[model samples]
Target chain A: MRVPRPNRAQLGAGALVLAALSVGRVVTEWLPEDPSPVRAFERTTTLDREVHLRYGNLRVTEVDGGKQLATSTSAMLSPGLWVTAHVDFTPTVDKVGPAYAELRDGEGRVLTRGSRNVLECKVINPGISGHCLVAFEVDPTALAGSHLALTVNVNDQRGDDMAVVDLGITPAQVATWKARTTPVELLMPKDAT
Target chain B: MAPVGMDGGTDSLRATGRWGRARQWLATLTVRQWLLAAFLLVLVGSSPFGGLRAQRAEATPTLSVGVEQTVAPVRLTVTKVRFGSDLGVPQAAKIDGRYVVVFAKVTGTDEKRSVPMYDALRDLLRIEQVPGVTKPFSTDPEPSSDDLRPDTILVADDAERMGDLAPGLTYTLAFVWRQAPGQPVPTSVRVAAYSHTFRQASIDDTYDWRDATRAAVGTFPATAYEKPAAS
Candidate 1:
């Protein structure tokens, strides 16, 4: 009868593997409930080192990678208007997930919840990047002449992980847009600003 | 049934193990694998990898809480200048082809989750604190006083086209908590009044929220309605 022979190399390898396995287990179990849903990503940012939040990539482009707006349309937005974000989600298998955007009011009130969806990719692949056309209506009644902030979440499934992006509403531009372009036929806010 | 069959079974098992490991690595990250190993380590108490991964898995199911706002104040910062040409009426008297985009972020630390981002925002904005002392700044403790709403908020001349305001430029906007009162104001502030100059425009800007970032202040700046002179 030959007893199972364990060489030093095998023994060392076994020990390392065991150690790694144990650490993983402890960490997972220890992570608090609802562990940080945000998956760390090393992408571009518009924030300084002090800022923990930044918009990675939520630029707008016509479908099929169309030309960007020649000049920013910062001067024409008015209160009570609808703006469509031709959001293009990516690389993830889900082209369209639970898509939605958030809007907060001057008083930290949530003015809107724009649903986000990977309109083109959910059913196809979980890792394939896709796009979603999210619709968000600007808040016309915020305490300030306009509201700020737009956060988006795109996911493949309901409970599965989600991709988030933060965007800041251009205030001066919004104000300028509101004052210059509002039409007459449509009763607009009284000339207050 | 025979020695030959037994040898074949052993070979198959070894092949299966190798394939499984490779596939697992592809699907998960190194840290994840390490975590798995550790959990299993603890789960089984010891198994080379100590089955730490298994142990962790068995420890407890994290309570996932989707952070978002069920109801929040009407906050939307978007600006686009619409010329009369865009509105098919140079003197359309209102903004017409304009677009403003808002951006925000949400972090989840709760135990259970569902649409965490939106949910958390809604919750935070809705049913604010009880001002005066524990909730002083609220001004009014009532619902209407706080301006908290669940659906979309609009501060336009009309409610029908609330989501589609007449395109125009030079209007006060909302900045829930992005920049601040005056410091770091938006890139450019439209200073014209009903001047149909630029049309079909979009402003890539953000609202004032420096105070919020500091977690020291509230009262974000937004486009307030400068009431009409009692027409």
Candidate 2:
């Protein structure tokens, strides 16, 4: 038995189909997964206003900065500016507190709270408000237009609720904070009246 | 048939030109000769750029003490090294043997995120000539060996553990190691600094700094620790 060979037009059609399949495969293989569409839900507010999260409500009662920070027994001098946020947290549904806290600068650089400063508010039961001070040692140059990000998730923030509070720090305030040499006393975290 | 240049000759005649010559030439070779020719072609193609020879790795640079060395995400400068029964830190009281303390100024170099000091700075420096000190081994089951790492990394001023380092902030850190008893205290010791590469992990796609390579080595003299006078 003899087999017929493909003609020129038939061969061209077959090659075109193979090329299209290869292009489709390349497109599917190289396309990136879009994680931005499922990013954390942000509740943005200014200082002194309460922002509701999925598990609790947070309010930044006060914001201050200085060149030195002092606790009850110990004090530390900052290499840069030290900004402290006084926050009041009241849980509604479940017992939750901000496990992850960071200061986001104007360039979007994040300065996380270090483990040395033990001033952050601990998790409390639902209803009663707990107050705490969260401190961040940030670069003096990155103080303008900074925001504080607080979340319940410790490691991963994807598909979770986050509270982004604007600190309302101006360039003038940054200049003054950078020049101040006095130490700011850090108060202990306690139950709010 | 028309002349060759007039209409490019007939199809069957053209087919007999190039393909016919190739077929005839292939038919003239013996099977052994054909195999030898194929082997020679592969050998020449595989070694296009001296691939058969071994490559020599460059030696790590030896830097002097107090010179800043970058190990990625942090720049370190070894300021001083001291040895004594009491190094003034709280851990010194608990340790049975003397403490070998190394003072360094560490600055965070990564701008986008804060780098945690936990085990990050421990893998960067290795002290030599310490008797019975646990050395870091890559094949060990533990991700990082605590025995080889510093017992504690404390801040020079407050004596607290140096935690996460923010960018552009320099911290005066004291890396403490308990000296193994029954060994003669050396007057000087060699310190090796390592560099790391930032890459995605194979198990999880998280990015981290890993694969430490010795970048710089230095020798520094150790001195007796003295308690600073109260202010």
Candidate 3:
């Protein structure tokens, strides 16, 4: 019995296959394992306009800021300005409210209600509007051109509806808010309108 | 030509090639030479994988009291160490044993988001050299189990439990450890501060500060236990 040697063409084909496999492996290794993309569906609206969410409707009725914020028991002073958003949530399907609320400044820095001593939105049944005040202690420099984001998804907001309300804060407004020395009262969340 | 003759000629030519001559030389090696060659090959191969490299352990920084240490996402300064029956906090009233309270000023360094104090500062300091205060899992025989975590962390001025630490705001925090009733009070306490890396978790790709490692160590003299003056 005789063993046959590989011909030039056969060797070339084998080398090509090996090179292709090596290139493919390198490309796949360089590719990201998890390319997490933004998945939230944002419904933007101006102040006093309602934005429809998947389970409810959100509206920023009023925006106020001052140097001091007075809670039910005591008042707290801020190193910077304290901006509070009076929000109204009307649930359409189930008992839901904005569990996640934050203030995003022009520089893209976010201040969430969890960071401040503020009241959270109370989840109410369908058909009635729930009123709540979401407060954020922000740097006075970041007060201008800041927006409020409210979402019902508490844990993860991916693939969910988020309400983005333009606070319409201007430089003059930020200056006025910073100059005000009086403490703004922080009210608790009301169950129904 | 006959098949056998052709095969013999091919074999002779192949044996004279570079690799074939090298193989013949290897076959002629004595046992000692072969062992030496094998060891040399292993030493050269292991060099790239760092197996033969010298272990260089980094010296942890020794920080003095009142000096600030930045451990990423937060800066901590051990301000004072005192022994007292009460920490001026509501929860301290119920805790009867003597408390070794360490007052530290913590400032959040992250500019973009608020860092939760529980996750960021809990493992930042470990209390050591305290009598009768055995660390959790101390009997496990693991070296890491020798770390004695703080009993509770609270806002120093307000006496409230610390929550999230906002950026650029400095808060004085009280890290308390309860001393056993019968054990003699320690004259001095050694404290270790840890550093952390902010990275995405393997389980859930969310980014967070993790992997706490000892960064600084300090020993402070324990003051005499004093009762608080009436507020």
Candidate 4:
């Protein structure tokens, strides 16, 4: 006729199972999928101005490339409409991957550096600041409203953290860049000038 | 002290008997039974299957020739393979072994998705001398025929590479690998393209190509190695 009460062992087991389930749910909810949670940290900054990123500060020192750099007389790279930028970047912390540059067209299409082009700006190490040049081959038409983006990705365990800056370019400037055919040296951090 | 109606001595004896029986039953268990119990306990204690799945997800899958496969935006096909010292380009340096020339055709399969331009170097394209083996020969590609010379061996560093490919556009890429002089010519060669995938809007954001279980394009019987000296 008396009601029963759960003793210590039974209550302890129940608490343990509930704890395990709570931990499992938290873990499953935290796991990332296609649109990863890490992408939420992706930040884009405007160029020619110093933009503070989680890892570093980046500024476009100069942007050069055009018909001249790609011409037969001083063909620094393969025959294409190429645009190159001089960047000054300083990493405040240890960044994981190489720093890379991407060029986007007026229509928001992306243009990577030509596969064979020699000029590539690499990532700078923490405490080491220097000059580097990044180049990309793009259709001449994209020059007018194109944006040159520079990014340094942080390889954090939880998700990826990247600092990106977009520098707007002009068509007349691209036309002028096409005429500077002399090959600019690609200077990576720790490389001998 | 004893309850008015219950006999405390009898209840104590029953409890002792129950404890003895339980101990005896456990002691009777064989080593095999103990091991099986431990295995089940481990299985229930910590499930490791979830960690295994997480590991497999990050593992990069290899890409191969002839197979019409899509790792999102990039669809690759190895149309023809030729092996000879002088098929595509003359070697710049005399070597003991022959050359393996692979001709691959690549296209963007999806308009919404885009991948980084394929580079023979960056894509990690290499040929396995024996099919399915992990041994990768130092490989380079002649993306264009302009640099090939009949009289001279082509410089590996000077090899041209394919450019960034957009949707609705296709490019045929040529790759070259050297088989060292004394090594037995591979009975069959497996071509692998270790490429990365990215979205068009976030082209810089990249992910390794996975999804397909097998990275190998269909393996083809090796072309007989004709020693250049014989020719």
Q: Candidate 2 lDDT, tens digit per residue, B24-53?
A: 687788777878998888778879776556
In model 1 chain B, which range of ten residues has the least summed lDDT? B208-217
Which residue pairs does candidate 3 place in steric collision? none
Best by DockQ: 2
lDDT minimum window of 10 residues, candidate 2 chain B: B136-145
* CAPRI-style quality class for the chain A–B interface of candidate 1: incorrect
What candidate 4 gets wrong by more than 4 Å, as runs, is A1-8, A11-58, A61-83, A88-131, A137-147, A151-163, A169-193, B1-67, B71-73, B86-94, B108-158, B161-171, B182-212, B219-231
By lDDT, the candidates rank as 2, 3, 4, 1
TM per candidate:
0.24, 0.77, 0.75, 0.47
Write candidate 3's Cα lDDT for B1-231 as tens digits. 223334446765554565666766777777778679889999999988886778777887876788998877788899878887666556566444567777888887888877765566778787776766634323222233237677777766556555566665677887877775666777788888888877888987687778888888888988964555777
lDDT by residue for model 3 (A56-82), tens? 988888889998877765566666677
**TM-score of chain B in each prediction:** 0.19, 0.71, 0.74, 0.47
C-alpha lDDT of candidate 2 relative to the true structure: 0.75
lDDT, residue B225, model 4 = 38
Residue-by-residue lDDT tens digits, candidate 1, B149-188: 2222222332211221211211232112111122222222
Between which residue pairs do clashes occur in model 2? none
i-RMS, every candidate? 16.4, 6.6, 7.1, 9.5
Q: Which is the winner by TM-score between candidate 1 and candidate 2?
A: 2
Candidate 4 lDDT, B1-231, residue by residue in tens: 333235556867677777777877887887778889998887776675652223544544444446665544466676656565444323223444565666666665544323444332234345543321211333333333222221111112223344455334355655555544444556566665544444223465345343323234355556743434423
User: What residue runs in model 2 are displaced by over 4 Å at the alpha carbon?
Assistant: A1-38, A117-119, A189-193, B1-53, B91-94, B134-147
